[model samples]
Target: MDRKIMSLGKSSLVVSLPKEWMQLNDVKKGETVSFNIQRDRSLVIYPSSIKKSEEKEIIINVTSNEEEILITQKILGAFLNGYTGIILTSDNIFTVPQTKAIRNMAGRLYMRVMEADAKKVYLQSLTDESKASLEQAIKRMHLISRSMCEGAFTALKNNDVALAKSTFSLDDDVDHFAFFIVRILRNAAQNPYLANELHIDPLDCMDHQMLVSRMEHASDYAADITRHIIMLSGANQTIPGEVIELMITAGTQVADLYVKSVEAFFSKDVDAAVGIMKCRNKLEKLDIEMTSKAFIGPQKEAELVCGICSIRDNIKRISHCTFSIAEIAVNRAFKII
Candidate 1:
């Protein structure tokens, strides 16, 4: 693993490549190699031929008894597994509903429906995983999810039904970015070339996956709060102003936690991660106060109380996600040091 630096001349220094690595890569004399500088200040040397490989392909055979939802699920799985080309075929013929489902599912993902017929349907991934940034997408995902929480609280405070309904649309944006990150991570796990291109190791991919999943879940919770808002929109009961302020305050704090934790994650700031933990204690204390106020509603205001309780719970879940991010950030920072 160690190579001595040798002087080629007064101006140049060189180190010999590892024999075992050269043999594994089928290196030959006069062949060129590409060297990439990593974020950790490490150099990676690889054969130029290994830069790109054939695209992965998958096929799904639809059966007569197979449900449309199950077929759509399988397509999603294949997409996450890094299959760029997907074929859906049926022994007899695709039903109208089945064809519709495949089309809809492909539309949902970053893939496009290339071709479709009674017996066969083709899907192609439009996203270039190599070009899609895993880290940047996750960072954006955190921002969007945090904003969803903030928007939900704002809508509740202003009694803006339209704004609450708009939050649900942002959920789709979260899914789009999350799906792209998941696909890239999955590909990076299976392909070393991709890992090199993405400048992330397999271990780092696993850590990122946890964050991506949490962000997805956080987005879902934000959307759930929006649903609760819509439900509470028509209710005549008035929520106490103090309780609403407390909810908004707690939600804003957790949103800030998300931003800080994610910043620590990429920057490897141990102190920032630790700060998130310190803030968590305060969030928990506020939760107790929010819970007691949640149960103080009368029968007429029970539905509104339920909405308030769900919003509080969603904010708590968002805070929990930030806690996980902070922990991961601490671990990653320690490893880096």
Candidate 2:
């Protein structure tokens, strides 16, 4: 709602607050309200008493026939909708799979299972939304995903099955961050006060939401690369050294580009972001050259060749994700510029 500006004195100007808002907050003529000047120079007025809002609560009724995947989605849906208290109820008792699914999803969402009985389970989120840092959380998310790419390539380079196995667990960490970031962004999108506290506008929230999704996807490809690596690096099955070295070098280059993209995003460096887009040219050329020579030398076994190609494809997919990230970085930098 718009308020008419009134001259208070020679230099001061004032605007009256809406009566409806004042009444809702129980503000009287003498009581003071608080306000914050947002980054865009807009003011957000709120009650001075600063009463905490009650956490949103949701209930999920679990039937014996409920699909585990559906249960997981229900919990995540509640979380994204800004619910902090989730209760799962069953008519009888939860099956082992049902209980396990709830526990796993609760852990992933940074929630604690506060209580569980034969017929019901209660989960509460651990983090205080008002105090969480969106930037730090996104940074942590990017760190894990970027590390996953590097780790996957390194695992392939060294033929370390143990290291390759870590991609699974690392991907889970990335997922946690993704979920956390999305939830925060969703909250910020709906609450202007929260957005000001988080130092993000609606546009920033949209960009972050998109970027987190890309990071999650890139991490998935990175994990896929590791799975192929594990398969090809088996004792009885080895891809040629020439093939491995080529894949490693190119994959590592992709990881480097991924790093540059995220750095450009953080720094708001338009030049660096544009440069990342150009660097992909060389990587793509290498992909072409490598594909041509993939069957040459000792790199010609049917199974090994297929596995090498799959790994290469996953690496290329990651590069695509990086390119999208750089594009977003360029746009974000322009917003500041």
Candidate 3:
């Protein structure tokens, strides 16, 4: 059942809970509980004597001389799957080749080699990359995504099929950017010393590569939404201006989330990521509300609604993909802390 809390004074407040909750928890007039003030300004109450689970130790071993691609895959997979600690070891001192790749990967995973020996190197994960390449790549992705959104909006607003067609061609640019990221990763993985000389690690480079891939997919989704908009407009001979505006607005929100999420990922900003996720929910709600509005005729309404629905679904999926990338960033930040 729903409950309400109200402020009573400067320092005191009262909360009314369902009688059922009171009985289920065995609460009495004199009972006490713990309270927490959430970021959203809501108060949470809990039993004071709740039990907590003990933290468990986890260890993973990585051997030196492992292929860079294979090593990165292993480390990232382990990190995502919840390994608490990782230990890299070699029979002798870490060679230049092994050390460079390992350091690169460590940077990407937000992990550090806490202890090292001829036989073992213990790592503590952390998310901190104050590098130009990473920053630039994120910025470019935002710019490109925003541009695509703007182009799509223009096409939809003016019912310009030519402009809409142009938006599909823009996907080529995004693909080019993705290829650039792949090339960077390939080079870094192949020559660890070059990465070391540049003061970056192969693993860190790989993380940036993954970020690029996600952004590229975001671009693809945006393009597909634009293509659908074009098809709908072309097929119907005309689309309601309001419907077009609604789609443009939704597309803009998607772009905003894409940009903000990428910024949060690079900066390790959890609040920013959370904000983007909330905004995505708002966009989804807007799509639903707009879809419910009726059009002039049955045939027109059906076509427009179907097309808008497809665009809406794609936009939501794009927002979700951005959120997923943000989640990875948040997880990386936690490992560091």
Candidate 4:
């Protein structure tokens, strides 16, 4: 192959590819190729001409006598491994124990089953529910988070223990909404038509499912902080009002960052995702400051310090989860960036 030396800069050298080699590969000017660095620091390049792997159809067989719990695990496992279909059969007519068990389990898990014959059943994936359900769930999650933040801040500002306790209870709603999202996505992944209708790729849908999971965990953190706030307000004790205000401000900032990050993910906005990363960095700095001031001693100081540490840790974890979601959005919007 012909090669020509080229200058990259005053301190660097480069080489040009052979024209004949490019032509033989049917590569035109400006075509892109894949490149990688090996462990030995050698560079390897391949023409971007490889084809995608073909999707496979997988089938699972289950018998009527099989325990329902076992069948449920198998179904979930097969779906996760990219199975396209499943078949259930029995030597005799399906018994009430088996049918009833499967039906109960399917309803609980949001899966669908079709009886193809006396001894055979077909299983399909789940999907997102009607638009009303989706919209309502999203709204509830937002409202719960907003209320929790408001209650926590107001309680801290006014030293209202009752309000703080009430805020902690709101975490139940956040957790419920998160579980609902997971159930919907799990169902969608099982049914081909529903998955397609929702525009969710079975594999890619896992990321969205995880985002919801992390948000729930973040809410748990928020609730934990509020609980501590309640404790401090009672027993005639308090953190410096200014410190409490700072913690509240940090928590609110993190919540806003998480919401924007979720929006960026849904909209595939790389710029917004990057903005979230910046906000997370700022939150981290504030956490460090809160931790330092939380440790000054009295009889209750240790408990208060530990509680502040836990709150900061949870908030930082939430930020990290938000960043993970943002990373997915960035990858989608700019594949090579």
Which parts of model 3 are misplaced by more than 4 Å?
A: 1-138, 294-297, 301-306, 335-337
- What would the per-residue lDDT of candidate 3 be over residues 1-337, giving only the tens digit for each residue? 5657789989888868677767877777777776655333445565545311112234545555566676566655555433446666665566666666667766655567788765666766442112226456557756776677667767767777887788888887676455544544554454333344334455566666667778787778779877887778667645566666776777677766777777787788988877776775688777776677535346665666677677767777777778877876776567421
Count the clashes in each prediction: 0, 0, 7, 6
lDDT of 3: 0.64
Q: lDDT per residue, candidate 4, 1-337, as tens digits?
A: 5467788879898777777777887878898876545333445455677321123334556665677778766665655444434566667777777777656645544456754677777765443242325435655776687577556656666767788888898887786576556655765666443444455556545666766766676667667767877766554566765567677778667777777877887688999998887776678778878777666554556666666666667667767867887887787666422
Worst 10 residues of 1 by lDDT: 293-302
lDDT per residue for candidate 1 within 194-217, as digits (tens), equals 787888887888889987888898
Better of 1 and 3 by lDDT: 1
lDDT of 2 by residue, 1-337 (tens): 7889999889999999999998888999998888888778878887878534357899889998888999999999999878989999997789999999999999889899999997899999877777988889888988899889999998888888899998757999999888888998998888777888788999999998988988999999999988877776673577667667778888988899999998888898999999989988899888987787777764356667778788889989999999999999989987861
Query: How far out, in Å, is residue 17 in model 2?
Result: 2.2
> TM-score order of candidates, best first?
2, 1, 4, 3
Model 4 — which ten-residue stretch has the worst lDDT?
50-59
Sliding window of 10 residues with minimal summed lDDT for model 3: 49-58
- Computed on alpha carbons, the lDDT of every model, listed in order, comes to 0.84, 0.86, 0.64, 0.65
Q: Which ten residues in a row have the lowest lDDT in candidate 2?
A: 297-306
Total clashes, candidate 1? 0
Pull out the clashing pairs in model 2.
none
Error at 82, model 4, angstroms = 16
Please give the lDDT score at residue 254 for candidate 4: 71
Model 4 TM-score relative to the real fold: 0.57
